[model samples]
Target: MAAGGGSASDPLFPPRAFSPQGRACLALGSPDGRVRAWDTQSGRLRHEYVPSAHLSATCTCLAWATGRPTKEGPQRKKRKSEAAESVEECDLLAIGTTVGSILLYSIVKGELQSKLTGGHDSKVNCVRWHQDNGCLYSCSEDKHIVEWGSQTCKVKCKWKGDSGGVSCLCVSPDGKMLLSAGRTIKLWDLETKEVYRQFTGHSTAVSSLMFITERPSSESQPFDGITGLYFLSGAVHDRLLSVWQVRSERKEKSAVISFTLTEAPIYVDLAVSENKEEPVKLAVVCRDGQLHIFEYILNGHCKKTITSTSIVQIATSGKDDGSVPTPIPILAVAFCSDKQSLLLVYGNTLQPVIERVSLKTSEPHICLVRDIQKNLTLKMKTPILKVKTPVVKSETKVLVPGIPGHSASVKSGSSGTPVSEGKRKPGDKEISIEEQLGAMDIDSMKAVRRGGLPQTDSFAVLLVQGLESNDKNILNKVFNTRKEKLIKNTVARLPVYSIVPLLHELTTRLQGHPFSALLMVRWLKAVFVLHASYLSTLPDLVPQLGTLYQLMENRVKSLQKLSRLHGKLYLLITQISASETRQDVTDVNQTAKLVYEEESSDEESEDEMMERDSDDNWEEEEEREEQDVSADKEINGDSDPDPGEESEEEEE
Candidate 1:
């Protein structure tokens, strides 16, 4: 129901890897140098397995074994039944690590059963288990894809066909073909150990590859017999995703569909609905903070597009009852039997943020779900453990010298006055400024303090800090000031009720942080100016003002940074002025003065002359326009042109 509900849980430690059974998520971080299991639904810890032999490394990828043993003998039937029972019974996790090692863990026993090492020269990036055979496949930055036997963790085959490092690897549902995507898509015949075909449509490196399966024809038919597998590959530079169909003979591949996106996806994972009833949908996450869902139609067409913030991985969990198949006789429905989809998003920032989107609903809520059991309980216990706690640290009030303080004045040229210390008896509480800031829970404030501006002072201090930081090129002070002005103008033109809550939030949560507060104040001022200037022409101002607001809301932390604030503010003001909102003339002039002051400090005489020449060109354009207007009026008095004739001439 809410925007971030599904992401309310804690992020998976060291990220996560999804199995075919999406209900169980695997966390491969070195929590005591071991791989752990996490239940996705309940956010509970399932198990933890540590292979004592494998130390000083982190697991990077994981896959579940789905293959059956191919041994033949008199004990075949009993062995098959026993294998089926065992395979269906216990969950298996295959882990790939930075050391180019693969470890197979038994979920029921919570122990490592088998380990494979040195197959890859570099870090393994992806791992997948063959559906029909007890075999494991992995791709690494070493530019190799190595297949291993499930029991021994022995390399069955190794394919090094890519020029660049292999980024992703996938196996066909039938286990006949393996696909490795890197600079291009390379297809390998698992049975023959031959590189059959190479597809090269991507301009950039390929990040992921998936095989979409067709539906079974009847209950009696085997899954591989009924369904045909097709490949979907995602590329980075071109921002192009291509769908290819393998010929029935399995010798060649044909490109059936392709689509371009605004951003190049870094890591693309796919999920297919298990219900044979619904249209095919593909979820893609791009590097440019966008999550896209594409619905496939007949004749190789992608009909719908939905976009969101940066999504890193996507996986499906079986089927649901709501996806009824339309009877339009389109493409064959191939469902993965999984009911839901898990999307791992890196968020707008580097902080890893994962979101689970339910295909059952168009508007999905994002919650920060934690895979680790400890975090899940912590999340649940956080609100219920109602305990009144007192601040344990006393606040320190610093009094600068020459500020006319009643006491604690420092001599000239000496270090500023020391903060007054107070002693509290046992049980008396005190709080620090850091603790107070933490309680506010404002994301931008956290960023600002982390960037070295922990103390808050008056507006003058803010301005000075902004100017000083501009030297580091971290803050664009002029643009930020202009942006703040725009926000202020927009808010002023809004109804009183609309502005009150924002102002209240600024005064309360943002207390003591005068720099951030001043920025907000300036934004409100700019919004007011824009609204007033375009009050009679609201239609034209609406879109531009909306863009400005959206930019501000999205870049909250960057706006709080004093260095870049002024530059961003000035740019916003210029944009607004260009949009016919002729307001804040004096403020604009002051901002210009500040910019000149900053830029003038570093310029030769020739550079200054060039800058002056550009200004003169602008002035000359305005003067020439005035002269042309006067001349046109004099000519019109001498000879008036008929309106109809002018219209006809223009049309002609």
Candidate 2:
């Protein structure tokens, strides 16, 4: 599985919501009217349900309905095993098509059960399942909605919708009220079959809408002592994201929280957490390939930051393939239940890559943790795709700019026109504005000091874009490997603020290995070299850097003192050696004597020890003097030894 479903097949429009099967399984409907089930955990294809009559109609909407309630009926109580079997059989799928049709398929039965047709004048845009009584509600471009029974697949009720079309819709968790978006968001009463309240703040058509149940921090209490839901909507033209704090019974009391995005928005999702301290999170993906995550407390004070970004660059050196990356639309983005990973889908032309990107965000420095889908095929969407296999002849090790999970063996299709490898058409080098990034934006990020650099996720994504192959596993190795020099060089490339998070990670690693924390010295050196200009301009960065410098200096000075002490100890030992000496006549006449004396042992004082050391020195000096005298006499006797020989000559 090189990537997700995106290859030659185009993605169904963003509004075709996925139905989550058993924990991680997802059911998706394609424009070709194909309803396939996939396991999100392993990226494996599961099932392809054969519908009765929607094979050619474009799939526009999907909804999953479970037949069994929380407590099973009397027939399910025959045995414990029957209760378990009943739950699996209750799951059903409803798919809406562009030709104004709805098809219902039973999962356990493995067959298309029923079909409803000709309810609208135009294409069906949205379909939702009402949990109670197996009722399904659907809306279409004909400005009408029809509620049908899941059993008979017959219309139960009908309501008028927006004048133009129903762009999107969702049923409440309780399945009583309906939320729909088109020109404006309308909340409808299912029982009364009339629009109960209309929320209007958009200057353009609303393209996306969702009703998310607000999870209170303390389950025992309600939000501000009131049970509620949150209504989120995004407009296509103005690119405005609006979130409403909706109370359970008060549509008039709803509060509007809105924001403008950098690019036209594609999709938005709410991420819930179990931890009370971690605020409720929201993620919004734009058509320009930017993902922003916003966290807010219950008080509505929001802290928003850009988490993931997409940038493209052309290869310029011999090691590079000279291939450029083009920014494409992000179809959808969602956070897994763990809140530490992001699964995203984006494939505009050639490369429709679905990536499960790991996140490291606990520390101040956010970085790419790892790539869950290691085998994902990375495609570069560009005019280069118009040729056969787009092979670069250079033996360069550098990675080409493209999608993440860089692939070395991604062969282009056989359908494109063939051309010489090194040749390009005229004006091929004229890069479009969307393909290139502005200089000012990159400069501002580089100049950050006190405020902080880009968030860790964005920085990590930037690092990935900088690489030729988008090989994120190298980042995994850089953090986990034991090689000292490699860690040193890699850490040098990270920004200065990254040290804050890296230090926290290394600190945890330091508990088991005492010496690993010393790597911070190298980190300090890198920060100095890379951010030297900011050191003076940014006054607040001084104190922390100075402390690290002092620590390194102290360690160096201690090593120097130890080195000098070793040299002095070596000289002292050399001065205390013994040599052989010749004896003389005066030495032969000398006599030896031994004497013993008793001394008091009342714990020797410092003074007495010093006195004894002085006495030993004096005795050693005297002994040396006597030995010198004997040596001198021996020398004189050797030179005067000829005196006996001279007397003998005179007598002769």
Backbone clash pairs in model 1 (N, Cα, C under 3 Å; residues 3+ apart or in different chains), count = 70
The reply for model 2, stretches above 4 Å from the true place, is 1-16, 21-23, 49-56, 67-90, 215-227, 247-255, 273-278, 298-319, 325-330, 346-355, 361-652
Best by lDDT: 2
Runs of candidate 1 with Cα error greater than 4 angstroms are 1-15, 26-34, 48-56, 67-89, 215-228, 236-238, 248-254, 259-278, 286-291, 298-652
Scored by CA lDDT, what does every candidate get? 0.54, 0.58
Per residue, candidate 2 scores C-alpha lDDT tens digits across 1-652 of 0001111023533333344433344566664567776555566666677554545465666667766534635652367786565565567777777678887777666678778875765677667776676788888878888888766767777778887787677777666788887777788877886876788777675666666565656767755422456667777665667766555565553335656667766666666544456666666766665566666544442444223232211112222576443434455566775766777655432223356776544443332222222355778976654545465543433333332213222222122312223455574554334323331123344335435443654434444433434344543444444555654566556665555445434334444454655644454455456556656554345564555556557767888898899989877766543112232224554565876656766666989899999999999999999999879989887545578888898999
> lDDT of candidate 1?
0.54
Best by TM-score: 2
- Candidate 1 per-residue lDDT, tens place, 1-652, comes to 0000001011222324444443344343442356556554454556767665445455665666543334466753467677654554366777776668877777655677777886987777777776666678888888788888776767777878588888777777666877888877877888887876778777665656777776544666666521255677776466677777665455444466775666664434445544455555665544443455555542343433333322222222323776432211000011233534544434211122234444443544332323311222223444567555333223333333321222332121112222233343465445556654443334554445556333453333343344444332322332244455444443544453333333333334234454665565564455355445444443334553554455456557565685577878999989978766555344434344334356655665887789999999999999999999879888779544576787778898
Compared with the true structure, model 1 gives a TM-score of 0.43
Deviation of model 1 at 403, angstroms: 34
Model 2 residue 540 lDDT? 46
Clash pairs of candidate 2? 2-376, 2-377, 366-456, 399-468, 399-469, 400-468
